[model samples]
Target: MSGEFGEEEQIEEQEGPAPSLAQIKHIILILSGKGGVGKSSVTTQAALTLCNMGYKVGVLDIDLTGPSLPRMFGLENRSIYQAAEGWLPVPVETNGVGSLSVISLGFLLGDRGNSVVWRGPKKTAMIKQFIKDVAWGQLDYLLIDTPPGTSDEHISIAEQLRFSEPDGAIVVTTPQSVATADVKKELNFCKKVALHILGVVENMSGFICPHCEECTNIFSSGGGLKLAEEFNVPYLGNVPIDPKFVELIENQTTADESLVESYGKSTLCPIFKDIMDKVLAQNRPARC
Candidate 1:
């Protein structure tokens, strides 16, 4: 029996093909032209929001050099397991919401500070393995958190997932002209890769005074919306500067229960809900 089983396995290994695309519904890459724009936060919240709305979601942190999704989803301690089949992603549960699977370079490297000093081809190969080797079951949305700017990792995802074409990409930026200016380049990069532009999300649009309830334009306002209008893309929404959000992220709080009770009345939650709605509306056709 053992000899026969081994022979069968060898034949299967030689004859079998890779997994089919029917397993995945959509692939959405979250991008930004520059860093310090809270693009990771947008990706995290978007995944959480989709899970909250009862959709199966997964996040792939392709930012090999500076992986942050593991920390953002509070899975820094968790690791991906390599089995005879493939790598297994760690699933993080959000209280009162659905769950999400996460895969990041952080799990592979033992040292957090170790830089990924690889060339474009090497980076592209690593990304391909991440997509093809990781077991991301059936997912409604597979959000790829890309490293900032137009680089090898970006090109790899755009090329490999070209068949999926992704539903679209969500660009994150601040409300400053400098940030919005680079967004055009990011958009152009997506167009060059034949990926659709879902919309732009302006993070830290304004600071809400926790004490006085007043809004202050810390980074200036309306640049993201204006850019969206000029590009003829939907304006997703803005995320205000919330000190509690900082604390929530730092503390690794994934529960939507406390967050809804605490900041549900604030503009951030509403705007995020609106963004989720827009994403859902856009995702419907792909879903069907």
Candidate 2:
């Protein structure tokens, strides 16, 4: 099946007025072909890493039905203020690493577990307003955490955002073949939509034994790297399955140095740094 919708003309005509895209340096879409691949975790880490590096960052949680960024960053109770023109994003600080402006349907719904029983068009409308109406002032990076699978929300954002070229996307997956198969579909979706593939991040690639300080290939190692090589894209890195990490997420704790050292074996910070380096290098304007 094709990724691009044939109804672009109708959408363009009926979208009311197109929103102005400005002051956004890079738009990074964190996506996956299937659910439960830790896509949101990867997105949260990327945003936090950028903030730690002294860059202004904003995260747009486009996962309307299941928003996790707010909870992950400890901003679930936060509220957005309403100005005359549009809504103002609530900024949350992470370990003195600048501020993170966030917008999610969960914020609007006021209940994390509330179901959003809207259709595709309604979802598309909300996304358009989130991108256009919200005031994301002078952001170095805007990480958009999208819902899994190629759906209307995904297509709407891909078509609407004017990035000069294709905005880069990071595909998240696990080492399991089922997850890899879905990632292939996601890859094809990105390629079909003309979005640049930043890289593929393999989450839960292995289990790091805290007792023995040895790594075990719980799911199998190097699947993401091999897939990236096969597709001629970059291999971002891997994040081990740590029980403590799971606990942190369950308890809505930020991934600061303490948490990283506790569970990540001093690897989370470095892995995030490397990913940021690659993202910045890729986003830099080509030398004339």
Candidate 3:
């Protein structure tokens, strides 16, 4: 069987209704072949950008081993509750017209320091349950923040989401050659699984000086664009390492504003807005 199931089994699975994902208009996965490439960061920015555009959004953090969405969105103290239908995701406060909600293993853990040490079967079960049991309600966009590489977790996610008609993946990578090499494998994995690639996003492409607000290519640049060209995929754009953005995540605890509100004031807001604009335009329904 290919990863979790044979081709015929995959078809049979997709024929059933996806309860949790039914009302989600568009589903996008933020992926990476290597860790520490800021895949979750990309997911966060994309969700915030979509919310700012007045589109209701949901973020599913399946990076089970290292669920950080709770801390990033300043909802670390939040917890998930069991509703009659399914698990209720915690809603995030945003100043925009749209709403944002999230579900992650991080919120379910009794302690933040606990590690998820599970075998393949257990992890696979959790991934499937996350896909089927979360009550996401209606969402204009559902962005899944995935762990790095093509492991069992990734395979389980692909198998479960096969029928949901995910919009596709946004591959995140760094400009460095080492990162690009591993990210190339992720591109191949997507092709093997027949997952349509929406585009490639090069994160940490440069460093934005906090003082002068000038961007310097400290890590070099163009590796992501090169990969996109080599693989014949669209290069969405590059995101610089903005210290202010880091401060934003770190300062979320003390800040009086909601994470969304705080992010709306960030300089990176315009950058991601432009990038997500490309995504929106590309995903726009073709009209007669």
Candidate 4:
């Protein structure tokens, strides 16, 4: 009995400071097999959608190398200020609702073009600090944006949050074989680590032309659903590409209410909401 009790104590010690984010109800990760599949964009929009649903959300851009949340949320030139609690995350206002707070290595970069070159240990330490030191107050959901492909970053997150047992991970992929093949590897990674998979999200599933509104199979379609079927996981939903959305993020500002108005009307918006609808319906407990 003493030995078992001692082991429990050791685990408590290992969890360290802020072991389990008590204030945050659910923690979810957004991962992709490879980059440039709009993983970051999807993550940002999902966070916004959740916020619009009246949930307090926070986004941790763990893609340290290519942290884009600063720009994606139109928070460029913003800096992280120190609070009495810890490092305060930059807040993102979505449709006049600033229900989201965000943190990213991009905000720490000296310049837009600067690079982050770090060994595995350094990167792991940074992730640990982000989990421990950030002042992430009460939150309904904390969406983590992981770097492309599974590597040291993936291992660190899975093990670090082993106790927290993140609600699950959302795998993002394009409708192409090259991306789907890697997504399979990503799914295997989640399984090996015992992380529940909420579902698979197919981004840029199709493209709708602005002029004629004709749908185009630019990147092909159905690969994500097929992969989900093979793995027996839920297919969240698919988001179509719209030029207005491209301009929204590329412009790096949400001050454009017209752009915001147009973006909310974009094809991707509703598709993303449908994906979240599946998520909320299937995992009602995640909301708690």
Candidate 5:
């Protein structure tokens, strides 16, 4: 019975209206075929940039067991609250640009080191419940950072946001052919599931020397744009490796608020803005 249509899928099989995400206008799920490709970074940067543009943005970290957003946005000690519906998210702000709210599995845990030992059924069910429970007030955009690969987490988000039809997913990748190969399958999976793709972003495409301030292709180049052309999806843009972004990561863990705020206008800001422009451009003509 567990082969395909099993008894455990009764929750999904039952006829029920999807939760109303009416408060959030656009939901963009960010994915990568493999981990360590900086998908979460891109997701956070995009959310911050969009919020900077005067849009109310919320980030839903669906990474589940390995949630990094709490530390990434400096909300490690944040707590969740009770809402009329369910648990409410804690708003995190930085340099006047921030999310309306953010919800991560980290906030619900007792300690940062505590493990979330959830299996498939339980994890997917939690995803469903979180979608129904989180009280993300009126938001212009909600960026969902998914665990790498086209698996349960990705499927859960797609199913939950089916009614909204999502603005689209932004795939992140490196300039390596190996990464692009995996991303190709991820792109096809999205196509098969009928999720529109905003486009693909090449991260760490080039490295900028902190001293010389010169850009160099450290991971080869053009693979992301090439893959987009091959798949006929838009090539959003690329982000070069910057020391400022590195500082952002380091300060996130050490609680260096002053340095973190100053780095908000890091070199990555301009690059992220260019990519978000393409995302908004594509997001505009579509609405469900």
Candidate 6:
């Protein structure tokens, strides 16, 4: 699968860790073997969980063709700014014990409807700029939300972070056999690149009824766990589809309340906390 993007590492010169990454203690990539498995949602909840735990966090959305973190974090209208260090990421109002900041091509595009139509070389260049140019300042964690599959952007990120010693990757997938099959390629990609697999998250394993709050196995559960076991990685946990969580992402809240704040009240918050706990247990300790 990765062979399709031949010599993608040569898109930019090999260098040390990006300037912004130097001050970051840990970096975790949110990845998937296929799309629409809620990878971005995992990244968002992870960041919010860490922030609520009192850790400073940054999120970089590298899904060039379909950047959606800005909308997920409810900062769609926000724009990036240039400072002496580099591009200043838009800050999320945590309104809690921690802080959250974000950088994404979504912020750079003036129009939400704009499409990023570019060749492999162009996409690689933009990804390089995103990795090297953003000024994240000091952060406890930087969660990179990547496009599904192993492609140009993935190659570029792997090349750039070669020296950064990233914490690892949290692979997201549904509890469907097909999703797990595609995700096997992703696990293989991690092994080939020597990137550590922190764990596997089974997102949308079931549907949580908004009325009764009972979880129903709409998609049939256990595929994600089977994949993790087959790959010899930790199975973080299963995440049920919650309507309130979707509302939290889509509904506009008051200025004093941020996504993180709103998430604290959601039923899924504890589920993600357990997943993050399993992740942090393997990496550097996060502040709480």
Flag regions of model 6 displaced more than 4 Å. Answer: 1-13, 211-214, 254-256, 285-288
Which lDDT tens digits does candidate 2 get at residues 82-153? 887577887865545555688887788766667999899899889878878888777778889989988888
User: How do all the candidates rank in terms of TM-score, highest first?
Assistant: 6, 3, 4, 5, 1, 2
Model 1: CA > 4 A from native: 1-21, 253-267
> In order, what lDDT does every prediction score?
0.77, 0.75, 0.87, 0.81, 0.79, 0.87
lDDT of 2 at 25: 68
lDDT of 3 at 153: 82
How would you encode candidate 1's per-residue C-alpha lDDT over 210-266 as one tens digit per residue? 889899999999988998999898988888887876677665465554432334444
How much lDDT does candidate 2 score?
0.75
TM-score (C-alpha, index-matched) for candidate 6:
0.92
Clash pairs, candidate 4, are none
For candidate 6, which ten residues in a row score worst on lDDT? Answer: 7-16
* TM-score of decoy 2: 0.85
lDDT of 6 by residue, 123-145 (tens): 88888798888898899999999
Model 4 agreement with the true structure over 44-124: per-residue lDDT tens digits = 888877887778899998888889888888787788988888989998655565388899998888788999999888998
Any residue pairs clashing in model 5, and if so which?
none
Task: Give the lDDT of residue 113 in candidate 6.
Answer: 98
- The lowest-lDDT stretch of 10 consecutive residues in candidate 5 is 8-17
- TM accuracy, model 3: 0.92
Q: Which stretches of candidate 2 lie over 4 Å from their true place?
A: 2-20, 162-166, 249-267, 286-288
Task: Summarize candidate 3's per-residue lDDT along 1-288 as a digit string, tens digits.
Answer: 265664422322455557778888888899999999999889999998888888999999998999988887888978999999899999988865699999999998988988889877898889889999999888889899999878888888888887677888999999999999999999998987788899999999998676797878877899999999999998999998877877999998888988788888898999999889888878644111
